[model samples]
Structure formats: structure tokens, C-alpha cells
Target: MKERWELMDDSKIVQLYWDRNEQALTATSDKYGNYCITIAKNILGNKEDAEECVNDTYMRAWNSLPPHRPNILSTYLGKITRNLSFNLYKRNTADKRGGGEVPVVLDEIVDLVSDTDDVEKEIDRRELVKAIDDFLGKLPADKRSIFICRYWYFDSISNIASRFGMTNNYVSVLLNRLRLKLHNYLLERGFEI
Candidate 1:
């Protein structure tokens, strides 16, 4: 039996959720199960943990949809999967530590912002988010995509370089320059960076 929703578009699948239809979950899984799993696996590095996170992503989407309709469903699901996987990774570290691009991703941004004695005293968390959003908005499209791919998706430099048809060294340099620009922008905004 062919799945009907398999032929449905993302917006229609999202609408099914808004209408409180259980088939929405099936549709979502059919369309994005592997994509979500890949993201979770990349971060958690455990198949069982990644599967659990992907299941949790569906539940979160179910709860959030009536109130929050995502313009880009895949990105929304990927973000939830990534976060759940990270939390699970943090929880499981005492028993077992799984490794992937996360450590490299963290290291790449280690010195991007200066460690402040009191960042909250200088700028509240909401304000900091806004500043970063503004800074990203001001960036060129390619730079913004590079930043998001590296930080948000935790993609490796080599992957990003291949995606953009650039050398690894060039991608690394571009990201470094973008981080410097972000650091300076934050400092200029009185972020105490």
C-alpha cells in the first residue's frame, strides 16, 4: 500500500498536525526520518540515542504546531533533533562518551567571543540573541550560510568547503574572518566581549 501523505507537500503535512491529525506524525517521519536521524547521529554518535531523539522531535512538533507553524519544517525538526541529541549526549557522558563534529565545532568558536567576568551584567541573553541575529542579517548570504552550517548544523569545515566548492583552508579562513567580524560587532554593541 502506498502512503498517501508521502505524496503530500510539507505545508500539507504541517497542516495535518495543526488539525490534530495523527497521520501528521507518520507523514513527517516518512519525509524526514532519515534526515533527522542523521543530524542526531552526527551529534550523539549513537544509533539508539539518535533514534530516541528523532522520536522526541515528532512529539515536540506535535505539541508546538498549533501555536507555532514553521515556515521551514525540515529546519525546525532538525533543530529540535539536534537539541535533544545534545541533551541526551550530556546526560550519557558519565556512562559513555560519543564523539563526532561537536568537539571540533566547539573548538572552532572557542575564542570567537572574549570571556567576560559578567556577560549578563553587560547584555541580557535576549539582547545578545538579538545582536547576533542582527549581525547575521547584515552578513552576505554565503557567509551567513557558512556560519549557520558550521555552528547550527555542526558541519565540518571539509563538508562546508565541499558544499561551496572551496578548499578546506579557504573555508577555515572565511569562517575565522567571519568570527572576527562577529566579535568586533559584539564589542561595538557594548557586549563586553
Candidate 2:
């Protein structure tokens, strides 16, 4: 089924939100709630925090769309949810109570880049995004989901295997192959190390 966002006009949704229409909020939730939850849960790990993040994202979107008619509402919502979840995670970390899954997942990549270096300098975010999109576009739907679940969503291979009803060994081998391909692509794009 085509996503509701793919079917409905984003500008219309923004207008409805600006008009204070409750149905607009309902429609937005109906369309993007799951997506927001997925992003938040991936970052926050805890269902409670994820739910809070998703609610916060909706409120933010409701307030912002009046002034900022977003061309891509889903992406905007996702970004807000991610930023809010990350901030919450940082606060927890500062309090020495870190518990989110994303922190540990991102830590794996932290050592790969110099602490002082900017991410943009190592890889142009736009170019990297485009490359990733192109790579994903070429993959079969199942393979693409596996790739996203493992790398983008930072799900462990064993976790992903369980989710997809596959063996861990199969997931591991598939991930290894995808990683090699991505490594080569990044190298060709001048991403050193």
C-alpha cells in the first residue's frame, strides 16, 4: 500500500494544521505516527521515551507548519524526533544514567572519525545521502530493509535476524557483503578510512 503521505498533499496538510483543524492532527498521526515511533524507539530504546518523543514531534510539527510549510513533512517529523531523542539521551548521559541503544550504536562509528574533524569535511552530507539513496534504490526491498535495519537503524545482526525470521549467520553474511560494497563506494567517493 502506498503511504498516506505519498497520497495526500503535504501543502494541504500544512494548511489544515494552520487552520487548527483537529482532523488534520488526526490525519497526521494516522499517517506518520508509526514512522515517528520507529525513529524514536530506535534512538531512545525505551518505549516511554519514544512515545514522549513522538508526541513532542507532533506538537512541534503542529506549531512549526504554520510558519514553515514543509515540503517533506515526514522527513521534518523524523528529524525533530531524532533531535529530541538525542537531546534526551545526552541529558541522561550527562547524568551518568545513559540507557539508550543509539548511543552505543553510534559509539562504534565515533572512533572511525577524528574527534576534531567535522562530518561534512569527511563526507558531504548531501552527497552521502544521495549515494545512500542510490545504493538503496538498487537493492531488492528485503535486502534494502535489512541494510537499513542493520546500519541506518543500528539494529544488531542477531536482533535483525530475529525480527526478519532469519538465522544470525545469514544476517551476518548479508551485512558483511553490504558493508564491503558500501566501503568500496565510500572509498571511490574519496572517503578516506
Candidate 3:
């Protein structure tokens, strides 16, 4: 029943997906649907677009599960929702500018790394990701979580402040400091920032 499926833990739900059971989809939606919708809505700024992105995320997960088993289901789902929402937001805003917390977040980090107009300056995405991962690993837990929440989840400063019980200005300051640290770290690692 629906209630029973809702009671299942993440690992069980993931197993159902691995087994190709139809109920896996239901369980995933039950567990992560709202979370995905929130991520999509934050980026796309429309309920309809968010819903579409969430649905697409489900489809993407279904297709990719056979070859990919995520250790953290929520993080995996959130990443998919965020990426899909970003792509949709980009296409919709091609004629205009995006208005929301998304723009604020982007503007804050835009200076950390310069735009790669020349193909020669483009680093392999995997290497860049590895460097970023190493940097995050070295950060204190609270700072790392704040950074992930702000950038990875596209969460607004006010929302992050509320969640972490910090003042909005404090959260903003922390994020700025983290960005500066990341920029210096990347530069020391020979990244073209």
C-alpha cells in the first residue's frame, strides 16, 4: 500500500529500483518528490516548470539506476533536479535575465572563476570536480554544509540562515569567506581562475 511504501527507508527504496520494481518509482516520489520540487522551483521560479523538471529527474534516475547506484539517494536526486532545473531555466531565460535567488548566488561566485572563452583554458571537468571535492573535504563541517546548501541546493541566504540559526548577514559573510578560500585554493592548485 502507499502508506507502507512511504515507510520504507532510502536503502530499501533504492533496492526496489535496482530490482526494477514498479513500486520503486512510487517510493522515490514519496521520499524525494517534494525535495526535488523545491530545488527545481528555486531555480526555475515556476511551479509548472519545477514539476516538469522533477518528473524528468525521476525518468533520468530510472534509466540510469542500472549502471549507477548512488550512495546517498537524496544528494543524487537533488543534483539531478538542480541540473535539470538549471538547464530549463537557462533555455527559458535566453531572451531575458533570470530574476531570483539563483541570480544572486551566481553573481556571488562569478568572480571566483573566470569564464572560459578560450578552449585552451578549459580544464577537464573531472579534474576540476576533484579539486573542488578536495577543497570541500578540508573545510569545517558547518562551513562545508553551508557552502553545499548555498551552491549545490541554490538555497537563499535567508533560508540558509533560518535553517542554521544564524543571522542573514552572518551567513552571507561566511559564504563570502568560503568563496575567497576556494579561489585561493584553486589558484594554488594551478587552476586558471
Q: lDDT of each structure? A: 0.86, 0.75, 0.85
What tens digits encode model 2's per-residue C-alpha lDDT throughout 14-34?
Answer: 788889886677777887889
Tens digit of per-residue lDDT, candidate 1, span 77-183: 99899999889888887576777678778887776555554765465656778988999999989999989988887777888999999999999999999988988
- Please write out the lDDT profile of model 3 over residues 118-141, one tens digit for every residue: 664455455678989999999999
By TM-score, the better pick of 1 and 2 is 1
What is candidate 3's local distance difference test score? 0.85
Which should have the higher lDDT, number 1 or number 2?
Answer: 1
Ordered by lDDT, highest first, the candidates read 1, 3, 2
Compared with the true structure, model 1 gives a TM-score of 0.84
Query: Candidate 1: lDDT of 174?
Result: 94
Name the weakest run of 10 consecutive residues (lDDT summed) in model 1.
112-121
Using lDDT as the measure, name the better of candidate 2 and candidate 3: 3
TM-scores of all predicted structures? 0.84, 0.74, 0.88
